[model samples]
Target: MRVTRPMLAVAGAAVAAAALAGCGSGGDAAAKVPPTATGSLESLAAEVKCKPNIQTDADTIRQAICTSSAGKFVLATFSTDRGQREWINEAKDYGGFYLVGRKWVAVGDDGVVTALRGTLGGDVEIGTDHHAHTGHTG
Candidate 1:
């Protein structure tokens, strides 16, 4: 059969739909728990051999600096449902994946995201834009 542009478009759309469907869940019940309980920044920092300099900037979230064997990264905890929703919206807008749990982890590089997978209990996604360097995500 001769492949046509229209045929390719249809096939691509189908694949994308299937992928989005799968994104509904990360496939691990544990991954659904709070990121802090399982893969919180303090936990991850210890795992990666980093020390976390933590701070609470608002009632909405807690941010931290994790300087580890891997590299410096930020982590955050949301105080309310609105904060979490805002985070998801912001992430989608900037082309990132929310490593879902009781909380989320947003990293900037594939390597950092990938390395955190085991701790996070699955693959985490990175953003196309530059991640905040100072502390946890906003």
Candidate 2:
């Protein structure tokens, strides 16, 4: 069977078109935890202090900071006015943070939160937007 140059070109174009179509339709398909699956406010408070970032702090302080003036953090599904859906951490006491995919953010008493953002890559690795180090304690 002999394939002509024109036939090969047409085949290549079709393959390209199919690839583009797949790319265009590709949206984040990961199953997000529903907002309604949240447990008790106290349980959510306990979970927050256990997180790596705030774990080192005293449990009392953690609870105060997380549940007191801060508020209870609940896992909930959220949608913007524009209808973009996201899994968010809705802080009931003090404002909390959210994890949209792997990105994380923390809200403080001032109601301002800092997000640790990253760039999505074809590889499974993510590059953080910032870095931090702790000073040695003598």
Candidate 3:
């Protein structure tokens, strides 16, 4: 039996759709929980009275916030501490900033507020203060 190109494309699309449906159904029931509402990073920084100095290696922080019983709803992750700090400093320079649950949050950069994943829980207040000196300034 020979399959035409169109037939193969249709079959592939059908399989992809089925796989996506299965995966969606397999999601955890707990994932439905809404993220926490930690105030903006800017507010946290102002409370501390220091510009954030975030680190470049902040995976530990992301895990802390992502798994916390109190703030697990946010689901943030930081590939690097430098990335996290860059967001904070950008927020300070701009304005609009808000925390999503505990893990990930958003801050204004350039002309838009962007969400960043894998953030440290404790560093939320300090923003990037702890990581600023570790040479992660990008």
- Highest TM-score against the true fold, candidate: 1
lDDT of 2 by residue, 25-52 (tens): 5433222222321233234433344232
Alpha-carbon shift of residue 125 in model 3 (angstroms):
20
Question: Which scores greater on lDDT, model 2 or model 3?
Answer: 3
Clash count per candidate: 2, 7, 24
Worst 10 residues of 3 by lDDT: 63-72
Candidate 3 per-residue lDDT over residues 49-120, each given as its tens digit: 334444333543432222122222222344445665555566544333444334345332311212222222
Candidate 1, residues 48-108: lDDT per residue as tens digits?
5767788656667777767655555566667665786677667655664444446545454
How accurate locally, in lDDT, is each candidate?
Answer: 0.59, 0.31, 0.40
Local error of candidate 1 at residue 133 (angstroms): 23
Q: Is candidate 1 or candidate 3 better by TM-score?
A: 1
* Pairs in steric clash, model 1: 33-102, 34-102
Kindly indicate the candidate among 1 and 3 with the higher lDDT.
Answer: 1
Q: Each model's TM-score?
A: 0.51, 0.20, 0.22
lDDT of 3: 0.40
